[model samples]
Target: MDQERARLLASVLAPGVSEYVVLLMEGDPASKARPRFGGGRTYKTAADTAAETATGWALRRSFRQPWTGNVGLGCVFFRPNRQRIDTDNLVKHVCDAGNGIAWVDDAQITAEFGVVELDVEHPRTLIVVTRHVSSLDRSDLVGTMPRPRRTR
Candidate 1:
């Protein structure tokens, strides 16, 4: 994003949001591969197991913020080793892990955006959760209004 665009968006939306971050173990992409089974049952790979474990550990370390209202989620995945991974595959694993603690449910997340980058030195996924502008409480809404409504 350009500086001017970022500045404009921030100016319009920053004040209404409060955010928090979770640091995730880098490069543990949840395995999407599933071998054929007799009954169509699927199992998790070792990598998937490690990823799920890491997700739980990371969530526990982070504060348990039960924001029932809508959330604005931003995730930055930093891969430690370059092994040609699909960026799209990373979202669900992280978001599902964040379900209860980060927000009421992943469905409550109204705005989601992110980037995938290489952090060879210190690889990690940074998940940021912010209160959505549209989800502010009625009291907060009144306080932020430009002027009081005039009516009998």
Candidate 2:
């Protein structure tokens, strides 16, 4: 791991939280390709399959057990070029690749955020998984929303 990545991973770590996981995959990030239908079968493209496999391997190396509770997933995609790509597609691939490794299923992810940017020198994907913390659980929610008016 490089110094920047190491610092990032350390920053997300909480002393008592054991469910946090961070994975840094070094390569041009791949988006989730649409499934193809042929010969009466629906299947993923070879490129998509290979990308998912590689992502899964990287995730497995970082997270040993799956998180059973609600999870919050965040990702930062550094692209090799200034090509336009859907951030949703990129996030989808990472979430799907984490199945059975980072979490039991992608549905367990209750919160998600993603960002895509250009990094011609070192393109990579950074993923962070942590236990979901709802806004209701925070003390700073004051004035953020008004209480519902009671109707008799």
RMSD of each: 11.2, 11.9
The runs of at least 3 residues in candidate 1 whose Cα sits more than 4 Å from the true structure, single-residue gaps closed, are 1-15, 22-38, 135-152
Q: Model 2, range 12-123, lDDT digits (tens) per residue?
A: 5322345566677888999999999999999999999999999998987777566666677878899999888999999999999988777777876777878897889999
TM-score of candidate 2 against the unseen true structure:
0.76
lDDT of 1 by residue, 17-123 (tens): 53544354555445333334556786666766667567756775664444566566666677777877666567667666665555556676666665677768776
Best-fitting candidate, scored by lDDT: 2
Winner by TM-score:
2
The residue pairs found clashing in candidate 1 are none
Estimate the TM-score of every prediction: 0.62, 0.76
Give the Cα lDDT of each candidate.
0.56, 0.76
In candidate 1, how many Å is residue 30 off?
5.5
Off by over 4 Å in 2: 1-19, 135-152
